[model samples]
Target: MESGGWTIKKRSNSSNDSLSREYVAETGCLSIVVLGASGDLAKKKTFPALFNLYRQRFLNPDEGHIFGYARTKISDDELRNRIRGNLVPGKGASGEQLEEVSKFLQLIRYVSGSYDSEEGFRLLDKEISKHEFSKNTKEGSSRRLFYLALPPSVYPSVCKMIRNCCMNKSDLGGWTRIVVEKPFGKDLDSSEQLSAQIGELFDEQQIYRIDHYLGKELVQNLLVLRFANRFFLPLWNRDNIDNVQIVFREDFGTEGRGGYFDEYGIIRDIIQNHLLQILCLIAMEKPISLTPEHIRDEKVKVLQSVLPIKDEEVFLGQYDGYTDDPTVPDNSNTPTFATMILRIHNERWEGVPFILKAGKALNSRKAEIRIQFKTVPGDIFKCQKQGRNEIVIRLQPSEAIYMKVTVKQPGLEMSTIQSELDLSYQQRYQGVTIPEAYERLILDTIRGDQQHFVRRDELKAAWEIFTPLLHRIDNGEVKPIPYRPGSRGPEEADQLLERAGYVLTHGYSWVPPTL
Candidate 1:
């Protein structure tokens, strides 16, 4: 129950070749069933990630098996071919590893069944039994993991089937975990209802709510940067900080997935899941232990403590002609751009505004967090007031960390200028392929490291913070401001920060370059 540090249990029979390999092997032989496995998510991310894990020998000798369930019927050979096509064995993967991966992919079994049908589930059970018998993995009951990679609408029914056929009938001693992806629900009420339904079949501890952003090395390093170093611990609060900015922007429009984009838009897609998760990491109080519960508890507190945003402080917008996309329905009010300022009502962050902005179809592409610090109150830098000191964590394109501080110019005029102590990943680390977010997450799930996984209460609190705004949007009380296709969102977004007494670090530029 202690949550201060990581709790790793040793598996008696399983071991890896090396410490690094051990990290993978300790997960034990896993029987993974990816529902909707033939879908885009499965092809693009899931299979490729699993292959990476396999290449690392994270699996056992009788180490692995993946089941793909969908309405379409496909042979194992075809599934292997499909998986191989998506994999990029560019680096960190050898020809032998690719051959092994292909061999492992042959272990993938596909099931064709409707989600709501009893016969479908009965058939699914048959497939599981077939894999178990084929692999002769009956020495000890292997772990069974169900990854619901389908849309949220189908989630409840799929979960119900799993409960009726899979969880109820399957052997209980071995670990059974279910992974649910986002957006977990449309709003707070839906989120709570979904949580209750999931809790019915799976305990909170057994459910692994996946938020891919948390799996990134840079994101996880945030904890190390704050807790591991003495330099940052003292200055990480309102006393020395000015404000925080979290931005996730995209240059391309909906890309013809407009129907799907219109339903949730930027708020639910990015701000609710990605941006808020990042904010919690930046704002949370240190947990007493590293248990999923403790870390999530701290994260939930940060989310719950985020004071409600006033109408004037929150801004929403839709890109021009967004509703005109063929896939979008008529009169769609979904916003493609959202910017809101939150005031955390906690001792460490009281009165400090955490500005969150996320939008699609912006100028440039970026996902970054900027932490700004207040200037030395009324002292030395009055004559050279440039801007607040900042630490920017760039999450994509070129992953890097930069700190802005005042440094003296080479010439001896006693004049000081601000410069960045930059740590660029692309520059500093050479010839190393930064593993994809999916790669890390899939591996973490196998390792049972819940530090990067979202907890139940954290999900609830996140929805609570944005519930009011969501309600307003549903009721048509807030109309989205329109911005150009190739710009940095609406003018109101600029005004939102300007009114907060903060300025954009790079003026009002496009979020990313247009494709």
Candidate 2:
């Protein structure tokens, strides 16, 4: 099957010039307001992404500007210089390209504002308006985007204040969208309440729920790999597919996020949002079209159709406290890790078990999806034959897709051995720079494509799948099995899968390095 939009091709000399000129020409009048200007995400992701987009001519000249909002009293030059240091280009970034990115950096400005005050928001509106004009020389209102990169505790207040004073007055005649970062809520009820409050100000369509995982090239390729391939469709059911395994593990511990980690734990922090979203992409029925609503609808259906997990089948783990540079509190119950088994009740995967695992501070760092197919029934063995077919979609450290199938061993020997058919960006594609998660997400918001963006119902459904486990974790009714920092999670994680006749191969290789 032909790859979707991900197949990178050499940009012809003319095409490269066209794209560069496009960047130069379209740097039109558009405005981006980052609510948490001094935060890490703003410094590392927001400015760099806008600069890259601008450098790529994704924005026209004089087309837009960026506003960084914080309580700090830094000058525009200070902000520009600070962001410039972080704007180092990805591989293959030419000096000319870096120069282009620096030019876009000039379009950025800063504003001082208290997140909760009307005066602060009013001042912000004034700043945006003043930048929108070229002293009566520029015409037409620019598109406006407000990105909330703040902690969840203050998301609601900041969003409410912005809507009331800043964004409410904008008449861009183009579009206005608000981007809300992750950890949607403490639980389902809270997420629902927060959603209601935000919905009061911005329409659901205008709210972009950010989950960086959806922005990965290969993660997006999941949809293409499934729907675009005619070969996999007929055998994608329980009868032919044995099980699905998703692993999202980090090599390092909470990195001083212990305070926040203590509140949400692993189940809510990763499983509820990141891992479940990945599961939906893998297990959901194909949508009629690639529109955001249709795709999310299918994902929600998969979540709703999943059979509830029984007490014995679910496994949870917590890492031993670490005295890292960012101190982790002693006696912290925050799980750095968790493993879960979900059985789908739908017709397609009636008996298949979807094993999900994710954690922080592990033995190694790795993320991927493994699809184990049913072995050929009543196979005639050439020798001591035990053939298994597996397809793995690796997401990080290295991005690639590999499939294992039995092949005849070369030589006169009629022996069969498992061999891999692999496709990895690093090995196959040259001079290609894959975009960061935020870059793709920001572009999607601008392109009006919600296909990769999460919607309200999808979030609600995801919370439903994990709400019981959340309560169990909170009440201490569910005892968390403990594991050391430099190892795969508690032995229980392995047993959870072992009891179901499966083993977690390569668990050692998947541990994060910080462990």
Candidate 3:
């Protein structure tokens, strides 16, 4: 098959026979339309990711053209210049790499339009069609990918415009797909309504619900770590695991995003989608195969097995001076921090507590999944004194997976100390540049892979688990406790963790090893 200028031929290798096949689009020119091109998300993530893909040759410069669509009236050059500062070159980048950035910027074209009107979309479609027809490709062989970087409020109308004015004209091998960003909705009913709005215009297969966390390197490795490892197979259940904690923390508060942050808070912004997706992967049973359907089927089952969150198991907090932001209301009950325990009523995790914790303006900045193992039934050396066995998967700020185990102290007199079996990505994979989450996900969308993107049923199940709790917070039935900005969330959160059977190792900290 021909993609842009590159040829992809299938090879029958024994090692690759079991690997999932890549879905290549039909022979044609490709057009990527960024709907909210004037927005911050477009400038910071969307364009940069596309630039990286172009640099890596995953996007063919000759055939792929990017169209930036928004209400802001800016020339193509102005749009390019707005995003140029963010297209940073990697360390030790050569002159050729800098030149490539310039070339990638040239592929972007800008169009001014309203999200709800057909006039802008018609002009946008005309631009895309002209590009598609300019290529020496066969009729009905063009691919169109629409990325909606706008807010959820505009999604329905924008989607209506796309369906009415921007759909692919040919019914041949060509296709049109739309990628929508989260938060999908504020609650369950709203999400369903939003889904119905889009579902009217496109099929489920054409809609890609993106959650950036699934593209994280460590989060992507969860399946292989669980199913491929012999040692973890038997120990990953209620029998040997004590508690699992998925945590997200940031040292800085909502700087200027108080208006937006005030609406979603920590739970809707982080826990409901990002952290919950990680939880599904951690607790889900292995799928029968690596197909997208099989994997998502298992994830839905995990979500369904989650028991309702109890009031006692939940803790919410707002950092000090949060309301001081001009955009946030003084009487806002929003939570900048939250720690909640989710229990799965399945055989593998029946009795184990899956702790989901996320907070802003905290003591540190990091995201990690900590799986603490049960202590040995009869401890001969009192290994539990050091710490319970733990497998810590750091998701950001230096990706690594380390196993904390009790090791004999390196001295004549035998004593136990906790040490790690570490696999730090930077140290282990020296020259490798891990792709950004947006970079990988954008490539997946282009390749027609729905493995990492959320399915509609999956989104529904996710909303189901958090809607009741969210409504209570909305009604002021549950209030947020106040805590100092630089401190770890409310003291009650740690107490909740302890109540959930998490054993904190007092005198030990595992630092990421340097070269």
Name the candidate that leads on lDDT: 3
Evaluated against the true structure, the overall lDDT of model 2 is: 0.76
lDDT, model 2, position 356:
88
Ranking by TM-score: 3, 1, 2
Model 1: CA > 4 A from native = 1-28, 88-101, 168-172, 381-384, 504-515
| Model number with the top TM-score | 3
Cα lDDT tens digits, model 3, 353-373, are 999999999999999999999
Error of 3 at 106 (Å): 1.0
Query: Model 3 lDDT vs. the true structure?
Result: 0.90
| Residue runs of model 3 more than 4 Å from their true location after superposition | 4-20, 90-94
TM agreement with the true structure for every prediction: 0.89, 0.88, 0.97
In the range 1-515, model 1's lDDT, one tens digit per residue, is 11111122333544531122223322224578898887888898888877766665554435456888888778767766777778756678877767786677776788788999878888877777666556554533556778888998888888889878875234534567788889889999999999888898887767888988998868887876777678999999999888899999899999968988888878898999988999999999888866666888888889888887788888999888887788997788898899999899989998888999999889989889899887667667453356667898989877888887767778968866667887888777777778878877766675666877888788888898888988898789998988998898999788888777574443222122222
lDDT minimum window of 10 residues, candidate 1: 1-10
Task: Please give the lDDT score at residue 40 for candidate 3.
Answer: 98
Write candidate 2's Cα lDDT for 212-246 as tens digits: 98998889889889988899899888888888888
